[model samples]
Target: MGEKQQRDRDLTRWGVSRRYSSLDMFYLFPIGEGLHTIEHKGRLFDLLIQNRGSDTTLVVFHGSLPPTQLTLPCLQGEGVSRLADVNLIALADPSLVMGDIDCAWFLGDRRIGPLRPILSPVIRYVLDSLNSKRTILFGGSGGGYAAVNFAQDFPGSIALAMNPRLNFNGTPSSKLPRYLEVCHGAMSRTPMLRVKRDFMTPNLLDDVNKQQDFDLLVVQNKNDKRYLHRQVNPFLSGVENPTRTWVSLFNGGDGHVPLPREEVAKLLKDLSNMESQTSDEYNSLGFESLGDYKQSVLSQDFS
Candidate 1:
């Protein structure tokens, strides 16, 4: 009823449903608050985690905005419940992360404020607990943006950003961007990648390369009416996306992060299978096929 109150129904609109695998979803914070000043703009934040396995953890960050009229439930992908062992975390205070996150970005630049480098330790702590090299990150819109930001600062992580906004500051104002500018104020201007000389070079993306390029997965539907699907082009202008990307653009659910249950199941299964495949079998997926052998070898590391 108020700004801080949260009422949970089915996080199904994001392509997930309660009917699936009954994987335990844990609310790490009733009123999720990430500490600020942990590193500059670093503040307390909320975490929505679905703890699953020791092998890999999937941290799901919501878009950066207050709320959305779209009302797409939290990413209700069947894979979440089915792969119960995979850890999932929605790292953000939805109301604070993105401007009043509707759909554009989940980890609101306005609220989260100029990408805190201080969050590095917390990320490392999570990795240590997971006992893995890089944890799988998930986000649609703003949350997707946050996933990229975090991965840039902390390497050894994979991100599945569904139609993510890869750049910040100097980008044209979109529906969500305009709203965040109006609400969160001077904070959103906090550059994720502060480059005094070339502000337009996607410094965040550049730094991401300096650390790890990420096993980046970009999923988007061509019919998306929110922003232009052309937004996806920025992801690859200077970066190397995953050698083997399993992109599904069919329009069934939300253009951002929605997919049918069966398809979701298949996608997850394939990803897991890819991770488990022997070196040769996994390479067949791609990379060497096009002389991108380096990436193929990287994928093999998962196995």
Candidate 2:
């Protein structure tokens, strides 16, 4: 249907090694990670790639966490403990981290101080390896922050963002920041964010300007309990990107993270439909309106 799907099947053929970071490891090694340089900023970004053959690259920015490899299974095992658990997981997941990771890896971290500058080397590495004219970026939560932030600073690439964390100025003053803050704190210099109101960017909803210059894709579950569809409404209210798709899956479940694959296939199919559209903004997610954003995607496609 599209390069993504074919690429997916091809990856299946190659199969995946164990979950180790190195392809050379004794495990299965379907994916590989390394350090690369983005000459523009003269900085190096940690790069992780899932081999799908071909050189078309997808640069995925992880959320507040270290990397998808470290985050997802952790989600499956310990499960999310914070209010933003769902947001962190779905926004940053297997696909963003592993999934159909083929081609060159253009992985980035949550490092602060102009993430683009810090990740310039990784970006350059992926671009240099590609024969295609376009490179796609996918991220959610903080990575969603990166998707938009990167698109804003580096406007040439395509971006797909899910329940992103673009609220740089909106975090609540809980006297302490959230746990995510502990990791990314070095960059922003703020402690962990307090829940809900403490850490999200203040004007995030109104800040999709960065999304304008490139091929952009957006995924959101109205039911996401963490970020709350209401929190992001202002951002998407007037978004004009035809390439953008707002999938209202698992409404109100966890405003932060996305539901498991058993619940997300419909949203995935929505992406598949894009293969035939010139540029689509599929608002197939069943939210009746923006305010009722938290209804269950499984329970209410009618919401």
Candidate 3:
């Protein structure tokens, strides 16, 4: 397809036209609490916003979908609006729209460039204009990967991830290879090399261990043996700072399923209320038992 044809196709697929990149461009249009198109480095970033004029903003990211599912998740529903003290902004992973992939962790395809780098500045621009004092990024499963991935860019941000895929190295899903083929310029097809590339900084447990600025709260269902063995165990084993990185285990749900929305809202509300406290006092945020769980992971062979 030609450039114009491709742009038109994307426009139809994404459903936005008025692109804004800078503060000047953003103010050119009357951006309110709804879906808006953000143009960053010639690529359109879809953002759904609920402008409550609050100091705190909850940025929600959606997880993977079935191949037949076309519409963006979290966009059509009343997402994260239960917390009235915060403004809302939700992002759709643009990579899902481009061909047979279901989840790319918002890593973006080669043509679209790296999404986190592009989106970091764009989101910061939007948050600056909104005068947001605090940010909380929320997601589950694949979306949880993206929530933690992007939260690193914004210091003092909190990432609430449930049953998150910490690294793409060992994931059996073909989407990672498909993403590498499509997004990373068709690099080496070898699995080992692919694993190396996938787990680079900002996208792996090793990188997350080095992160001290942002608080990470990972909620895992104890019944989900798959995630416990594949993701949660390995992640907890590598955690450097127990205070900053919290692992909360619940005794419900099966493999890869999300926690009840009511529980999620409670955690978010707790984090939002404690945003004003210094980093030292963050351990008192009602997750004091996380270290015990981490110790249990270490004692057993959950890996």
Candidate 4:
């Protein structure tokens, strides 16, 4: 089968209907929005400019699907309405692999550097043009992995990685053959594999430890069988400055499920309202485990 046909079949299998072109899908954003597609290094990215501009911009890296699939719809239906004032840019992996455009967890693919040359200039231009003081990176799952990696590149940026798989090399505890297959494919396509060990989370923590300016928020379910051992535990333990990096563990869900749209919106809104923090102060928030968190929720005691 042809590439386009295969993509169509995949989308159909995923219960997604291609109602709009990749670029045209941005119209689903708020009315009177300036949305356009830009080509960088032969890859297409959607840029959405809010009518009433602000110095804050949210860069969204979608999970393992095409941009036109699940991510765009969620942003349009759930995120855009809640974050109408914030500038938004959505990026997708056209290759549909977990390399995430060279933003993988493992230190493989020497050709795939820390930052994509094509995207760096555009990102710099956007930040400069808006005089953006606060840049927030948001993503879930595979996209969350990308967010964490990219957050290091942009100084003083806040990153929210929901249920991120910290190590691509380790086998997922869950039974997800397709996800694993795609990830392996991405790794195989890379020209070189510099690091072979399964220490991606530790390496990431080490990298984050050097930078004392940014905040990394990792959200995961304590009951997540897929990455509790492989990703979350290692990340929480390895991070040098516990004060700067925080983990918010919830109850009653697998690693793959995303937080509710309302809750996510509220968090973004709160962050938007707050002044950017210069120091990385440790906030002892969230629960130690799902049991503790569940008890608090049941007791209606959030304090």
Models, CA RMSD each: 9.7, 12.8, 4.8, 8.5
Relative to the true structure, how large is the alpha-carbon lDDT of every model? 0.45, 0.39, 0.67, 0.51
Model 3, 122: alpha-carbon shift in Å? 1.4
Q: Which candidate is the best by TM-score?
A: 3
For residue 119, give model 4's deviation from the true position in Å: 1.5
What are the clashing pairs of model 3?
A: 110-183
- What does candidate 3's lDDT look like per residue over 1-303, in tens digits? 122112123335334445567535775665666667666544556777777777877888887765445454324224445543567777877665555556778776667656777777767866877798888888888888888888889888888788888867654343566666555546565853654454344346767776667878788887888777777677777777676777677887677677777767666666666636454445565453356766656567543
Per residue, candidate 1 scores C-alpha lDDT tens digits across 161-229 of 666676654243445434444334423345322322221224346665555645555555545634322
Off by over 4 Å in 3: 1-18, 21-24, 27-31, 40-42, 72-77, 83-85, 171-174, 184-203, 275-286, 301-303
Q: Write the per-residue lDDT of candidate 2 for residues 1-303, one digit (tens) a residue.
A: 122221121123223422323322312222243321112222222233332343334555655443223222211111221111111111122222222232111222233332344344435544554443445565666666656656654455556567755454444222113323332332244333332233233354444543455555556666664454343443544454424333344453544655554434344334333443232233433323332332323125324
Candidate 4's C-alpha runs over 4 A off are 1-4, 8-33, 66-85, 97-115, 173-203, 210-212, 278-303
Measured on C-alpha atoms, candidate 2 has an lDDT of 0.39
Q: What is the TM-score of each candidate against the true structure?
A: 0.57, 0.49, 0.81, 0.65
Better of 1 and 3 by TM-score: 3
**Which candidate has the highest lDDT of all?**
3
> What's the candidate order when arranged by decreasing lDDT?
3, 4, 1, 2
lDDT at residue 239 of model 2 (Cα atoms): 52
TM-score of 1: 0.57
Greater lDDT among 1 and 4 belongs to 4
